[model samples]
Target: MMTVTRPLTGAVVLSCALSGIAAGAPARAADVGRSATHRVLDVQARRAGLTTAAGGYPGWAKTTAPAISVRRSAAPPRLVAGAQRGIDVSRYQGNVDWAAWAATGVTWAYTKATEGTYLRNTYFASQYSGAYKQGLIRGAYHFANPATSSATAQAEYFVANGGGWTADGKTLPGMLDVENNPYGATCYGLSKTAMVAWISAFAARYKQLTSRDVVIYTNSPWWALCTGNSTAFRLSNPLWIAAWTKTLNALPGGWPTFTYWQYTDTPIDQDYFNGSYTRLQVLARNHA
Candidate 1:
């Protein structure tokens, strides 16, 4: 088991210099073209205060219908010792029977909130409120689209809709779903430096708005490739590792331990919040 010693307080800045990506490497044509677009969005986000309600903002005011995809493994979930059970849900699960689900000893859940700058989950209302009403701690996450829009726009859009925290004890802090890019290109078509900066902008804005650190959800390989294996966020956010294997062979992002492990995607994306159940409760936004 890994141990975390850093207090979740200030934002951590990662070096712009990624190890694998040579500093002098010629810029990719795709990145060069998009850099202009990304800068505009960044500027627009700055003009609107990060904490303001996400109305009239560049991405916040826009709407784009999103297609949903659900994929789950057929294998049974692997268990981690001394971990509290949890689950993450999206439109793929359809309408959740929160009562039935909670009865299974699931203590917490994270649901899909916003994707990119436009698409919001269709079932977010039912699932988010249903989990809460069923006496389970619940949080929302944004599926990142670094290639399509700036992180600031997406971050504001996410918190404005469903990712905001209220200190109600039932609320779990927002999470950033930064894994495979659903759009074109594997690393969201971004250079490694841009990837780190995009994530930094999102995390900074999220912390500024919610007064809480966001949980990062991604696999070790993705983290290594995208962010150059930077541990910059270790001090400010919790790590949600997505490793489906029985034995966790590797962990990334500079943290010695993981807070959440998505061990399986089968039977509704089962997970373990790495701690005692009571400790999990204490991590809730409004828990007294």
Candidate 2:
């Protein structure tokens, strides 16, 4: 595994460059055509308190959600020698060292593609393709913003930017990162029923566009509170559970088991496919 040298405490950036960030509060559709660099800058601005409760990259929801925090493990488990090791990155990671990661046994990755109806990852081009060059199975993910736009609209936006799925065995299905609202409300102002409907609508639209089932990345408690533990997607969509503990525990939304487990966040977010390398290939080919 890639040896992470970053400290255990929350990774903090005390200062941020906010010169490119928009002034005051955000408009309903201010992100429509902004540059990807500026989009990432906006997230940094929010984290630095310029935009307050605006938006963030993936795993941002882990902070403000319900009692989901636990004593983090020193390192994520290996399970077995052939465990399918992986990592997820956003513009926050900038350009990555895929070669070093591959040398350390990282065989797959998910690169953040888009958020809301706009704001794509600035480093997506490099990060997504760089992993592929290293012979790693890679895919894209969209951080959900249910309050800003329709689920279908966001899904279309996500796919259009870079979340598209390919049948190639190295290309996994696109993922929807739905969790606590990084903005104001805990559930993005949507009630439990509305949240479930929103997710279902997004999944259906994504499938309509790609003819592939979408993988959902969410926290268990957040899922319970936001979707009322809806079981509508139990069989169809694959689960990518975010639980940063030593071992996996109770799952959310009636999913019998998790397909992908995001078990930690230190130097960067790390994950593992639940099955073997061949099984991971099956999922990539949309067979699993």
Candidate 3:
């Protein structure tokens, strides 16, 4: 498998510099610094959980049952309109009032669940439950550290914590968050071939247990580093691309037409939440 080196923590400092928050201001400056600090803390917390190495069946294991095939039917339930909009949430955001946000054109949400082989977000269950109670369609995400010893373990962790697929044979499946990590390696330790095998095994096991497809969430460079061929993995599973370029049209060329676009880091007004809320939209392909 190809080995991907994790970016250094200095990247976080650089991110703060680019945030346009002036340095050494008064109390307001402190707030900006606090936000930057929190952002780094969130990333560190997520990375800590994602680095564990325990779980998932090995590739050599016999296929006890057939792998579940994810089919996109023409009549899939529409979670959002063509201009679908939603947000991703975690503990950092805190106690989201889903009902309040629902009124603000926030149509869907993806919550952070597991990070790696052993750790889970303590807040995931309550937050996810809250979103559901408030009638928001929800998905879960796993902060992926492909450099860890067992990618499959990380996948299993996400599946177990996020709750297996829903009863309708469909799930707001878990996404693999493959952005740059500061402490560990990237893409795990697999070459493109091995990466494919490892991820396929992991994804297949999750599908077998949950009966839902595992979605791959990535940016262009990360995807290229891990799986050079975006189409090599399960084609039917949905793709959630993070392209924060100012224009919505700047999506990478190789990605399957994405189902969800993480357009920006800034949050929009959401009544259910105390502060700003992130926005997202479901793509038409996955709606059905």
Backbone clash count, each prediction separately:
2, 0, 14
Give candidate 3's root-mean-square deviation (CA, Å).
14.4
TM-scores for every candidate against the unseen true structure: 0.71, 0.78, 0.62
Q: Across residues 1-288, which tens digit of lDDT does each residue of candidate 2 receive?
A: 011234323331111222223344234222222122122223422332222122454454332323432223344333554669899887656557788778878889999888787567767898899999999999999989898889999999999999998888999999999875654566777888999999999999999999998999987666776787788998999999877767754677767667888877666788888878998899898758
Could you tell me the lDDT of residue 86 within candidate 2?
Answer: 93
Candidate 3, lDDT over the whole model? 0.48
How well is each residue in 203-264 modelled by candidate 1, as lDDT tens digits? 99998998888888876555665677787987778888776656665567667667888876
- Output the number of the lDDT-best candidate: 2
lDDT computed for candidate 2:
0.72
Model 3, 127-204: lDDT tens digits are: 688777766667777766566547667777777777455643223666666554433344454676777676677777
CA lDDT of 10 in candidate 3? 17
Among residues 3 or more apart in sequence or in different chains, the pairs in candidate 1 whose N, CA or C atoms overlap within 3 Å are 169-286, 169-287
Poorest stretch of ten by lDDT in candidate 1 = 55-64
Query: What local distance difference test score does each model get?
Result: 0.64, 0.72, 0.48
